[model samples]
Target: MENLLYLFILLALGKISRRLSAFPENTPQILNLFVIYFSFPATVLLKTKNLNLGTDLAVLALTPWALMLMTVLGIRLIAWYRRWDRKTEGTVMLCTGLGNTSFLGFPAVAAFFGEDALSYAVIYDQLGTFLGLAIFGTLVVSVYGTSTRPSIKQIILNIIGFPPFLALTASLCLMKVTFPLPVIKLLEGVSATMIPLVMFSIGAQLRLRQPFSNVKPISLILFLKMMVFPLMVFFCLTMMKVHGPVLHISVFESAMPSMVMSGVLAQSGRLNAEVANAAIGYGLVLSFITLPFFDLLLKMFP
Candidate 1:
């Protein structure tokens, strides 16, 4: 409980800093790029080098991917039925499906499930969320976003250029190689900055001035993201008969709020800023209530 308060305090401080212009506008984006292209990959490589891959690992990793893909498609279908414009449709799809499983989800999981469960969470996050962002996420951003198709070249470059993906490749290929203690320490130090930097960047990007005309749509999307999505994951895990740490981590990942990258993509694709802001804002606000519910569910799960 105290730890959760600390997390909220840090988020609030980040927001306050942004409002006060403590950092330049572009600083967060640069930091985000560094994390995405460098720190995250190093963290993955350093952390998951000795991960004992197993059937449970595969199930935990794949569950979120399947759930997110289904949610995205379902939202798109609903948007189509309602005749929503491209911007609204795109915003709804991204916000409802993609989650901040790494940034916010990791700490919450660590608090509840401890350090050992973090490795499995990383696999679920990087292999599932990061890859989903590069491929399916990119496709959605491109399809409903701009007038032109995002080139295959661009997508390939993004997937290949992502530091985490490269790190995963390196870890798999060089599993036998041993790094010096000093080198490992340096990597660990840098990796530690990824989360706070990501959360602060998210705080900086939040726009609270968006109109409330679409309050109903925003609330519905938030409900799906913060509530329905996790429920779906829980049902799926039950059907699969997953238990213990893997089960706990699956629910934790499922319960994360919407991804900040959704808003970034929305801005890039020229989607409706109002809808995008609403989705992110409401998602963040509601996660405070929903995350604890998830924690309770995990405690009660057999």
Candidate 2:
């Protein structure tokens, strides 16, 4: 719980800074760049370099991918029913489908379930969530965004060019090689920066005074992210006869808020940045309570 508290404190600090103008306007963007290019990849390498590729590992890796696929379909239905504009539909789709698996998933899993379960969390983040964001998320942006649609070649290049994906590939190949203890320690030290940096970035981007027009979409995003998405993951995984810690972690991750980067993507994609940012801010605050409730519900799994 201390870790979670620290995360909240960092977020509050960031919020305070933004209100107070503690830094330049571009600070958040710089922090995000550091996270994307350095901290996140370091964390991925720290966690996955020693990973063992096995049957269960592959299945655990599937959780984020599977849940996201479900989310895409769900959002399409919701968008159609609501007759949402192209921008709103795309923004909602990104916010509801991509989860805060990295920023929130790691520390929360370690706190609630113990560090032993972190590998599963890493698998979900690196293999599933990160790839989804870097690749499929880009495709969604192109299709629904005001920007010209990217060709298949651009999509593949985006995935290939992602630092975290490169790190994943390197880690998998180097799985058999042992890093020097000093190198491991350095990587671990850098990995430690990810949570605080990410939390602060999220808070910096959060806008508390959302326009009234966005309330409905934000509400729908919360429901899908905090309740519907996780429940879908739980039901599907359970029916597939998956059990134990992997199942628990997967469900817990799905229940998390939208990825912090969704708004950035929204803006870059020329989608509805307001709605995407609002969804993330509201969804994250709600997750503080919803995650615990979901944890209790998971305990009921027989």
Candidate 3:
């Protein structure tokens, strides 16, 4: 409960900063880069080291893959049926299909599930959602993007070049070898910035003006992201006989808002940036309601 409060407080602070013009507009971008390259990797390395790998963990890691598959198929069929343009289809696909697994995800999971279970959230973010963003995300952007279609080689290289992916590799290598206590402490201190910085960044970028104008698509996006997608994850994982923390954490992470980075991707890719940004803004606000509801629903599972 206190953890959730901390998130809201930090978010309010960021919103306040935005309203007061306390920082340069580009500040969030730099903060995002730091979280991606420095804070996020540090958290992953520290948490995942000395971690045990198992089949259930692998299933957790694969959750986003399943979600993305469903999203792509669903969006393509819907677009075909509705005769939506490529850009609109791609925008919705990116925003709704992916999630804010890292930023909002880390803190929310810690708040709801506690620190001990954070490693599961890490797996869901890095292995599941991050992987989707790097590979599959790029594919969606390219296919729908006005930019020249990138070669397959470029896609592989881009994934390899991502700092978090590199960190994942290094962390795997270091799993068997213990680090010095001082180094571990250093990593922990840096990684701790992830939650606050992420929430603040989200708040800073929020723009609520005319949010209701795009109500129809935003409503659909939220339904898929906040409710339908998470429920789908729960039923699928439950049928596999997976229960307890793994099932709970996976579903909770799925219920997060649209990825903030998805809006950036939409703009850069020449997709419908307006819809993407609207989906993100509204999704972030609505998630506070849906997340807790799903948390209670998952508790009823077993």
Candidate 4:
């Protein structure tokens, strides 16, 4: 409960910052840059070290990608069918396709399932969603960032230069080398600041009074992200008889709101920032209702 309170309070404080004269207009953007460059990499590097690659671990990590694959395909098909503009398409692409498996997911899972569950959360996040951020997020932005498609070279270059991707690659290479205790503590300390900062940024940037124009796409995104896809994951996993924490956690993660960094990605890519912000802000509010509802349903099976 305290964990959840932190999220709501931080978000509310961020929203309140707008009314204060001290915060500049660009404060949220600056926070985004800091998150992308510093906080994100620190979290990745800290969590990924000493990862064990068992078959079960592989399944845990890959579940999010499966969700991402469905989301990407579904969004593209819908966008093509509706003839939505590229900006709207791009907004839906990044926002729907990734889950907030780190910031919000970490605390939410801990609150429901207890702290031990966070080990699985880390696997799903770092291996699955974090990579999605560095790979798919970057790819979508590059392709739909402007009217002209980027060259293959440019896309590759963007991925390669992406700071979080670089950190992920480096973490993979350093898996066996144990860093000194001081270094680990420093990384942990830095990574701890990520959620508060991100939530604040989301609160600051998100407009509560969303435009009606974004209603259709945002509604679709919420439906898929918060409801349909997670239900699909639940039933399918249950059919497979995949019970225990794996079943619980995977299903819960599938239902998380859109990745906050995705909003940052859309803004950075020059996509539809308004739609992105609206989707994220609304999704956060909706998750509070939907997550507990799903939790109750999961307990039925348990």
Candidate number with greatest lDDT: 4
What tens digits encode model 4's per-residue C-alpha lDDT throughout 1-302?
56557777888899999999999999988888888888888887987776775687676788888888887788889999999998899889888889888878998999888899898888888778887888888888878888877899988887788787788889989988999999989889888777778878878877777778788888888888899988998998899889888888888988999987887788777898778877887888898899999899888877
Model 4 ranges with Cα > 4 A deviation: none
Could you tell me which residue pairs clash in candidate 2? none
Question: Which digits, one per residue and each the tens of the lDDT, describe model 2 over residues 161-260?
Answer: 7676688778878888989999988888887877677667667766778878788888888898889878988988899898888789889988988887
lDDT of each: 0.72, 0.78, 0.78, 0.84
- Report the Cα lDDT for residue 203, model 1: 60
How does model 3 score by TM-score? Answer: 0.74
Which is superior by TM-score, 1 or 4?
A: 4
Clashing pairs in 1: 41-164
* C-alpha RMSD of each candidate structure in angstroms: 3.8, 3.3, 4.1, 1.9
In what order do the candidates fall by TM-score, top score first? 4, 2, 1, 3
Pairs with steric clashes in candidate 4: none
TM-scores of the candidates in the order shown: 0.75, 0.80, 0.74, 0.92
Q: Against the true structure, candidate 3 has what lDDT?
A: 0.78
lDDT of 1 at 186: 87
In candidate 1, stretches whose alpha carbon ends up further than 4 angstroms from where it belongs are: 18-22, 82-92, 110-123, 130-146, 151-154, 162-164, 213-217, 240-245, 260-281, 295-301
